[model samples]
Target: MIGSILGDIAGSVYEFHNIKTKEFPFLTPQKGYTDDSILTLATADWLLHGGDCATYYFRYATRYPCPLGGFGGRFREWLRQGQQTGQLRPYGSCGNGSAMRVGPVGWAFRTEEETLKAARISAACTHNHPEGIKGAQATALCIFLARDGKSKEDIKNTVEAKFDYDLNFTCDGIRDTYQWDATCQGTVPQAIRAFLDGTDFEDCIRTAISLGGDSDTLACITGSIAEAFYGIPPALHAQAMHYLPTHFQQIVAEFEEKYGPKIH
Candidate 1:
């Protein structure tokens, strides 16, 4: 989860001012965490309560409305509707929002089936579109596989076969032409590619940001997988934790305590 938060904070600044290279600073004075981390912690909170994710997701967004990590237009509207009317309906979006909050599902479940099922249930709250659901499931599966000690090649092949995403494009190849697309189909594979190609956790984030699409979402998804494959450094983890509010940090700690290897 810190991995996902760090990636969100790292890429939030670059979401618009894309640098297109992996040579940027490793961030100083971390930007406030965005919808990504907020929703992720929300998902963890939902898991702690053993209920549907959408309830807590909207709850957290309304409670912690940070403008720094901007929400998508549709998602903003969804939150507004829920807050005003207290009635919820799926927005029929295939956005990467589903994938951004899915890291906890990967960590909390033990089996591939459990991970995929939980991912689908969580995603159905908002990203019920098939591509949206696929993105969340694929990401959770990747994290699960990596934590389960599957080889990168094995992970890559399995994800490709299961999700049918074109994993052939390299970040360097896509960096020049990638546009700001939020759809899961547009975002997830590239994020996964960054993780697949990276040499380490930091490299995975740099690769995702360098792709220059939806920077925070791309890096957030990549960072979760990177954390599973290459555990976050303690200092780096502490730094990201420092950027979050105390309550959010406590949720992360509690989630890990209940469902983590704690220190891989």
Candidate 2:
């Protein structure tokens, strides 16, 4: 989860300004946690306390209400309606929003089946479309496998076989042609490829952001897998905490305590 936040903050400045290289500054003064981090917290919050997924998601999103959250149009509308009516109904979305926020589900569960189940629940809150659910499940499953000590080759083979995500392209190949895309179909495979190609957490995030498409979400997905495989550096973790609020940091601490990769 902290990994995902770090990616979001690092990629935030480039999401709109748009860059195509990994050589950019690690972070900018304007960098801050975005909806990816917020929704991930909400998912963790829900998993720990036991509540309806949409209810917790809506509750936390309302509390934060980040206008620059980078939510897709339909998701933004869903949030608004849920805030007003105290209800959230799935609107059949296939956006990468479901994938971007699902990192915590991988950490919170013990078994592959459990991780997949939790991922489904998390996505069903808004992204009930099949592709959206697949994206979330695939991401969560990758995190689970990586944390459980699967090799990158094994992870790639398993995810490709199970989810049919077509993880064949090199990040280098995708970088030149990749445009701003927010769909799971367009984004998740590339995010996975970023992790597959990277040697470490920072490299994985740099790889994702360098693709020049939906930067925050791409890095959000990449960081989830990278953290599981490589763990986060202490300096990087401290750097990320500097951008998060006390409330977010508090939950992050709690979740880490319960699910470990505990900070020293």
Candidate 3:
């Protein structure tokens, strides 16, 4: 969960710039958390409270309508509508929104089947599209495998076989390939590669942001994998927590209370 938040905050500034190199500044003091952190915290809160996901989603989103960093317009609209109507209807969003905020699902479940089920449930609360749900599930699965101490090669092979995503794109080969796409098809696979290439948690995040396109989502994807593999370093983990607001800290505490110390 701290991995996801750090990824979001670190990559926040570069979400639009799309730099395609591994040689960019990281951990600047100016960086801050975004909607990714807010929603992730909300998801954790829901799970901790033992409440319905949709109910907590609407509740938190309504109470904190304008997060420190804004949400996508459609999601904001959904929150408004759900608040007014008290109905949590599904919307079709294939954006990285699902992938960016799905870290807690990986921690809540002990088995792969349970992890996938929780991931689907968490993603379906807002992003009902199949790809959206799949992206979330795939990320959660990667984190689960990483947390379970799978080798990078084994993790890559397993994810490639089960998820059917194109993992052919290599970051080393794409030093000059620049594109501005945030779709799951465009980002998730490469993000996985970045994790595979990383030596540790910070390396994974730096590698993802260096790839440049949709940096935050890529970082989120890589962060989840890195956390699973290396766990969060104590110093970086402490620093990541500071980027979050007080409300989000409460949510993290609640998550730890329910889900057992985040395991890392």
Choose the strongest candidate by lDDT.
2
> Residues 57-92, candidate 3, lDDT per residue (tens digit)?
777667776754577787888887886887888788
Q: Please write out the lDDT profile of model 2 over residues 14-86, one tens digit for every residue.
A: 8887789989898778788888888988998888889798988787777888634555678779988976887
* Model 1 global lDDT (CA atoms, 0 to 1): 0.88
For model 2 the TM-score comes to: 0.97
- After superposition on all C-alphas, the RMSD of every candidate to the true structure, in Å, is 1.2, 1.3, 2.0
Q: Poorest 10 consecutive residues of model 3 by lDDT? A: 255-264
Q: Give stretches of model 1 more than 4 Å off.
A: 261-264
Greater lDDT among 2 and 3 belongs to 2
What are the Cα lDDT values of the candidates?
A: 0.88, 0.89, 0.78
lDDT of 1 by residue, 31-121 (tens): 6688898898898899888766788988888888765857888988998999889977788889999998999889988899999999999
List TM-scores for all candidates, in order: 0.97, 0.97, 0.92
What lDDT score goes with residue 207 in model 1? Answer: 94
